[model samples]
Target chain A: MIPASFDYIAVKTVPEAVAELAKHGDESKLLAGGHSLIPLMKLRLSTPSFVVDIGRVKDLNYIRRTDGHIAFGALTTHHDIEFSDLVKEQLPLLASAASQIGDPQVRNRGTMGGAAAHADPSGDYPTCLLTLDAEFDVVGPNGRRVIKASDFFVGTFTSALQPDEVLTEIRVPAPPAGTRGTYLKFSRRSQDWAIVAVAAQATVKDRKFQEIRIGLTSMGGTPLRASAVEAALRGKSADADTIRKAAEKAAEGTDPPQDLNGSPDYRRHLATVLTRRALEQLTAGR
Target chain B: MRHRVAMTINGTQYEHEVEPRTLLVYYIREQAGLTGTHIGCDTSSCGACTVEMDGHSVKSCTVFAVQADGAQITTIEGLAVGSQLHPLQQAFWDEHGLQCGYCTPGMIMAAKQLLERNPKPTEQEIRLGIEGNLCRCTGYQNIVKAIETAARTMAAQAGKEVKAPAAVS
Candidate 1:
């Protein structure tokens, strides 16, 4: 699976990486953990003339507490995120999902920024990020800017990022304490991509729904929020009947594509079943 | 274009000017001539090309040699010292852990990491730990036994070190 011949530049700093991208223009690809880009290159799905390796950018591998969020360095590996105590304490939904992506080796080499920027519809982080309301930091010759998770994902294998831009950070706003969140991925094999996945977060105040967010993966071109379901559950009593009703509409507006995993209708059913299960689990932990 | 990639494999440093697309598994096998690390699947699925890179197990096929330019890698070939097999290797032989042996290197490497993290991993943990490595011949019963044996053996060694007689005090 040798990829097409390409030039590789190991960039030591974010500025250097941006400069390389600027130099190569659209021919350049910012290589982070290389788990996503290299596989694409090997399959001939992606062919870039210049691959600026940002794995050597030391400053871009951090997990820190920012003003009102936990900022994950763009190049933070899945293994790090899964094991980081801060992530476990602050965002267990994301940490648990990170633990389920591919295998230990893949998790050791895959980066959050690469996964989000690649925007694989079945990818793990996008679902968690979409539900968690994450923000992506992009830097380029023009300047640095932040893109909300909702607006960042444009379509299948596409993002709002320009070719010359580098995604430098992923900032997840800290959810309130005592929030119950869980990620449910139904896959055929341990390392297989999710056939249908769901991430749910809820905050219960006096046994009533204080906040509710649901994110679905592999349901469409982009990670889709069960907006109707969320609307139904928000501000409602944390009751089984309400959750079941909201989760019944899980597949209402999704356009899932069928692959070898299952049929579209089967996935939709799984989405409904898993959504109910996820909501139940979220509320049960309260 | 080729880039100069120098890495430490099994305590030996090797330098090569490999193409940007050259995978680390090929570099270790062809350039370094350490064929113990097998390449069963070039797509990084089988985990036959697993190797310890900078203290973490990684699928060598997916990692470009240039990406591992300065990393310290450990392959199956490095598991034995002076004809004495590593505990995991010995346990595999004792427990009949392999059938075709194609996935041994990767299985052991993955097991090494698992045991390192959880020395006394339960059977379920052992199965979950080596889920990345696939062995077609063995249904993982014996493989689980081998890891358990190795974990116990390693724990005994650690215990001996901790319980060493205090200087005749």
Candidate 2:
């Protein structure tokens, strides 16, 4: 499959990339990792006239902690985060999820920010970001603004990012001292996208859940928070029966899309099953 | 849409004006005249087009040539010196890691990255490391055997190198 011809422009700075995007408008697409964008281009699903290569932008590929949050530069690849000691020790959910994404070659090129911005409902990073309570920093001609992960993802293959704005960084709140997190993805192959996924996080004190958060992927048009299940689990003790009962509501309020991967009913069932596993594992492991 | 690009491939510098949409696999094969890198699925799903870019293995079909401007690239053609095959290649040959030989180049490139990061990988680790490269022949048992053999040979060679340099100087 041959992609339509396009002008390629590489920029070293965020402002320069933003200017290029503004000049080309929607005809231009920012190239980072190129995992999601290039495949779409090859299939003619997306035909941007100009490709602004922001992959080389300086100081935009790092993972560090600041102000009680882990701020990852937008260019940080899945491989980097998966192997990062900071992510391994602190955000195990992120490390685990990044490690499971699309094999080694894909992880080497795929960026966490790129995946989040692509906003694929079945994608791995969006749900992780949603569960982690991430904030996206976007820069434009006017200035820079931070958009919360919940508000940034608007629909399938869409986000709140304007055509002229460049996503510069991602900020995620650090889990509490005793909190642990886990992600469960049920993709058919190691390199394939998830049919249904669950990301569970909690801090148990004396077996009682001090804080609980669960996010579901591929159950709808966007990665969604399992709010009903989360509400039911909050303040509850971490036990097999309690977790199973709470996970029953994991698919509430979600309209799962019917596709070749799974039926809506089947996806709902997966959500319930995976949520139970995720919660049980998170509580039992550490 | 032709864009000027310059880069080092296999320790040699090359410059050309290529279309912005030209995939890196095509650039290496057509523009640079290196046919060792094979193209299986142009959609980035197949790893037959894999190559090492600046020390990381990537699917070249997914990367536009212009996007790789100013970066150093290593395709399968650059893996050996003279008539000497890379350790992985020799190991693959000895271990019968293929039936059709279509995925060998990409598989070796992927295994090179794996060994570079982890010189002595276990069998399970080698299998996990090459998950990106798909061999249609379904001869994964032999491929894993070849990688494990290569890792052992490479480690021994590295040990000899460490000893030889110190002895000579």
lDDT of 2 by residue, A234-286 (tens): 89988889999999999999999999999999999999999998898888954
True contacts kept of 2: 0.78
Native contacts retained per candidate? 0.64, 0.78
How do the residues B48-167 of candidate 2 rate in per-residue lDDT, one tens digit apiece? 999999888999999889878889999888988899999999999999998899999999999998888777778888988999998999999999999999988887888754221110
lDDT of 2: 0.90
Which pairs clash inside model 1? Answer: none
Task: Indicate the residue-level lDDT of A19 in model 1.
Answer: 87
Clashing pairs in 2: none
Per residue, candidate 1 scores C-alpha lDDT tens digits across B1-169 of 8799999999999999999999999999999999999999788788999999998899999999999999999999998999999999999999999999999999999999888777788999899889888897855999999999998898888875433221110
Q: How far out, in Å, is residue A281 in model 1?
A: 1.2
Off by over 4 Å in 2: B160-169
